[model samples]
Target: MVENALGDANSVFSSKRAALRVLVNHGEKDGLTAARMILTGIPLDETYLQNRLSIPMNDEKKSLKGGRIHIPDSYYLMGTADPTGILKSDEVCIILSFWYMHQ
Candidate 1:
């Protein structure tokens, strides 16, 4: 199993169900540094990853394709966004939160 420079714990890069992850370089954290790995659950090295960055997903069923099990809109009881620009990487970690849709 390959280790993460910052990838997921169970990401082995060889799993049949492994999904894609896009690590976008962002701001810093605790003076160490931080990046946003958009998609999650896949362990790929720099060389392997760099070659496929931003390769947009073109699947119809996002949940099935992206390792994200769909949450019915009816299940979305309520939510809140601070909107104060106070969220940080540590303060909030997005493990496959957003997804892109095309028409």
Candidate 2:
């Protein structure tokens, strides 16, 4: 569904290929947060870190504000393990958080 959505030229998400790939590779929640961060061009900060790359649960169940793409829970699980052994979940999160902070 996500791959198909990305192919639509008229879709708001059409240009967000990289972020979508991250979404597919990772999971919807983190992927969406990363995509928003990319779109907003906002540097990671204490506030964002405190929030932990997640849309608030109440807000998440409904549609995302501003008509952003929302991946339903049925499409993916709450958590995903990395297929490759290159990094553990904590390590990956730490690296991403660090990279985002430094940027």
Cα RMSD (angstroms) for every candidate in the order listed: 15.5, 16.2
lDDT value, candidate 1, whole model = 0.31
Report lDDT (Cα) of residue 54, candidate 1.
20
Off by over 4 Å in 2: 1-24, 49-103
What is the C-alpha lDDT profile of model 1 across 1-103, one tens digit per residue?
A: 1223123223323321232321221112311111223244333455544334323112213324445433323222233565677886357533433552110
Model 1: weakest 10-residue lDDT segment is 25-34
Q: Whose lDDT is greatest here?
A: 2
Clashes of each: 0, 0
Estimate every model's Cα lDDT from 0 to 1.
0.31, 0.42
